[model samples]
Target: MYAAGLLNYSEHPMKVIIDTDAGVDDAVALFLALAAHKDPKCPFEIIGITCVLGNTGVDNVCRNVFTVLDSTGVSNIPVFRGADTPLVQPFIRGESPFFGVDGFGGVHSLPNIPVVKQERTLEKESAPLALVRLAREFQGELTVVALGPCTNLGIAINIDPNFVKNVKELYIMGGNSHGVGNIRPCVEFNFFVDPESAFVVLSAAWNQKIVMVPLETCKLAMSSMEWRKQVLGTIKSSCSISLKKGLLQRFEKDYGSWCSCDAVCMAVLLKPSIISKSSTNYCTVELQGAHTRGQVVVDHPQKTGKPHNVTIIEQIQLAELERMLLSTFHPSTFI
Candidate 1:
């Protein structure tokens, strides 16, 4: 796959921009990214973080991102605010039920944690436009890790036709591989919230891999809450400690089974080998049917002669995930 003089990624730091809606798990993903960035051996460098509407309103998401950064003592990465609403509909008002009222399990209200608003961010630049600018600046060296609805990314593609070409790759955490839905009968939450944008991002010809860690694949991380609360909770590290604060309410809510949907995406990004099984298929979001809107329709039969647009991860190694989680939560175990 080497073209003439193209430099290998190992030769330079692979630039990454995290586009997220700061839910509880989104905070976990950010903690993982921050840990990787601190490592000297890691090949990727986080350039910036973008906010979009998803688990909560865009404004809340932006604030929540700052909260994570503040909690982790990271001040360099610039947070860019993006689309407050989906492509077709206005964003849902008020906080979501999953991540408590404040999206971080009301962590900001905790006495130990200070209220952190949008700080140390590029307020002038919009998120979608920022994505376009970053892609051109980094050229083929940039990877966009999407952790929420595809609204911001879709707008970026619409902004610049060359966006997909300039960017090296995309890693998304959304959709459902088995037609199982969290928000609707056949639709996943992120896609269900914004089907138009999901369809747009999936249909594009990126010239690089679009690795999607859908719901079914993500559910593989639901192994043991005991391991999470005890093993991982005992790990005394800045990242882990900070993440624990965000996950306080979650432990009681989803106690028996534990699954950080977005964190699985981060783990896959950190170590692709963890993906023991995957299927490269033509994947698209359904936007028309009354009950089927936002469902991910994968061409498993290979009837669509079109080139595969996305690599749908079917399974991951749970053992490998545990190893990566250790490294992510405790940076010293990066080996």
Candidate 2:
């Protein structure tokens, strides 16, 4: 029955809005989203791409978004520049040594595509506002896929108490289960980079569905040299070409193969059944603590008595995940 349930969820695709920092894996996630949008079998439509500051500065992230869209030949999907810094912490300006200087390893030049301007007169709202507006417009019909710090989404929830209720589901790529951390012994990069924003977003009262791609499981899904060769070797799109020659080359030289955080996030969006052993827990971010700051403090023992806001994904079937990842790049096999 468990195996059958996973198979069932993999068959349906959901509507998604990807909020990212445009890191190397974020680029791969964007490619996956674009691929799903183009596939007739998968009915996922990328409503928009919002840039945030995590892997790089906000300006560079915005530029990277445009570059990826241009390379993928997708101009209709709007890209919005989000918050430049965290709500409480000082803006830490650091480039991702792992992802290369220009985020996408300078594989493809920054596209000359024109930035999308907002026509609505609400003081030309930021990315968070755009997200709130879209949530209201497509209430209960959209899924929020967050691949970076939760600054924008948290701001949106603060703007309206019922802000997140409009969305059907929320998929977040942060937090660490099993008491392990990627950035530190207790914190992951995404949540640690902006703990205040993460706290606000996770504390919201909306009862909508939530799926968290914890670092515990995501770390296990790392990309191998063989997988990169398979994706770059088989796909023939313009995006794939640049990803193969440029991004993959730098990735192999630097990090061996990309970590699968963003890719697993995209896969979860496409097929939720890839998840197993999810538990409802009350999670909050620790802004204090010198070494443990930005850590996701999960109340598994009901210490807080607060309602569970996060569904922590604990296990994933490796065989099925591998199959899905391979199938995503194969043109003959859709969904």
Candidates' RMSD to native: 5.6, 5.4
TM-scores, all models, native as reference = 0.88, 0.83
Deviating ranges (above 4 Å) for candidate 2: 1-13, 94-96, 109-125, 229-236, 241-258, 330-335
- lDDT (tens digit, per residue) of candidate 1 on 1-335: 21111211133466899999888889888877776675666677899999998888788898888877766667778889999889887645444467766566665534443433434655689999999999999998899999999999999999999999999999999999889887777788889888999999998889775999998887766757677777766766444434553565555565456777898898788767677899888889888989999999988888989888898888888876666666566634322
Strongest candidate by TM-score: 1
Per-candidate local distance difference test: 0.78, 0.71
Best by lDDT: 1
Worst 10 residues of 1 by lDDT: 1-10
**Residue 279 error, candidate 2, Å:** 2.4
lDDT (10s digit) by residue, model 2, range 1-335 = 12111223344556668899887778767766776676655567888778898887777788777766665555667778888788887756454455666566666543442323333211245788889888888887888899999888888888877677887888899988666786678788889888888888777766564678888877676667776676445554445423445556655775576555787877777767777657878887777889888888888789898888888777666666666555444433222
Per-prediction tally of clashes: 0, 1
Q: Which residue pairs in model 2 clash with each other? A: 140-166
- Report the backbone clash tally of model 2: 1
